[model samples]
Target: MSAVASWPVVLSHGPVTLRPWRLTDRGAWDEIRRRNASWTGPWDSTRPHDSPEPPLTFAGMVRQFNRRARHGGMLPFAVDYRGPGERRGVLAGQLTISGITHGSAGWAQAGYWVDQRWAGRGIIPVALALASDYCFFTLRLHRMEVAIRPENARSLRVVEKLGFRYEGVRQRYMHVDGDWRDHAMFALHVEEVGPGLLARLEDQP
Candidate 1:
């Protein structure tokens, strides 16, 4: 069986710290949600309603994160940028491990989103590489896959840049922007993990 099948609360990288979500993050998280409403609406699942009140309250968000963690179905993390002993940025993303066919499949999936303000700054790549390493090294998972919308060029670039192989399109695979969207599938297997991933940020010139 893959280690990820049984592992819980695995921290991959970063002082780039990937930790459980906190209530203190509500203000910053809500602000980003408000600002990126339109920019992310087309692809994100949690866009708020037009009404004055948010559909999900701060406490609700915490409950949901905790529930998922308890089930071992997902690990939702609040990614923080640590510099000079302060949390500088938020990388909002989740890593999901599902469809456990009792170590037979040995596969899991990953997905992530960075605050738009931090896009193109290489934060996603670093976080992705760190997460990927954890899946292979710590979790002992055999394969990890990422699916991206075709229109999301920035995301596509991240996957390709990381050397995740093109695995073709998954038709109407994900519910995003309130509709079923096709995703271009990309994957990296256990054999593909290596020190090369460490050079991803450095080689991005």
Candidate 2:
């Protein structure tokens, strides 16, 4: 586990925050999933029709993420944006540091989704940069990876902007929508960030 036991409770940079999932987040999760259905469905992973567990349910999701965190194999976070809000934070989507491996590998993979309404606002890249920095600094991890389907231009743009070096293509990487999909992999080591990803973004106009 990371040195910080309270990891993922909340981490912020500018208007973006990556925090742990909460049971009370059910309403927002349901609403956003409904609104972003067509926008996000194509990229989302799917289970076979005969699968026993439901594809997604808020309570089940909360329990699943909490368990991963407890065993130190994952750090699942809900991404939020605070943009001129009247008060509380609003859920934009989610980001997860899953399949975390320690010891020799020291590796982890990041996965995320942003509400369609928030697209083109640079939320995913900034949030990812934040998460990666936390993993490198707080967790002392060696490598972080983000894999995106070849056709997902929006997501591809994110890693491009963040300067994640392209690795290669993975054939039939995972089940997406209703069939297997290929993905392009990108990765960055801790030493590459220099001053940090958030800092780099801030230096831009």
Q: Largest TM-score belongs to which candidate?
A: 2
Q: Which residue pairs clash within candidate 2?
A: none
TM-score for candidate 2, please give it.
Answer: 0.92
lDDT assessment of candidate 1:
0.68
Residue-wise lDDT of candidate 2 within 1-205, one digit each (tens)?
A: 5553354457887778888888999888888988889999999988877779766677888898888787778889999897765465689989999988878998899998899888878899889989888778888888999989999998898888888899999999988999888999999998898877778777877
Per-model TM-score versus the true fold: 0.79, 0.92
Clash count of each predicted structure: 0, 0
TM-score of 1: 0.79
lDDT of 2 at 5: 36
Q: Which ten residues in a row have the lowest lDDT in candidate 1?
A: 93-102
Candidate 1: segments with Cα more than 4 A from true spot = 1-15, 46-56, 83-102, 199-205
RMSD of each: 4.5, 1.9
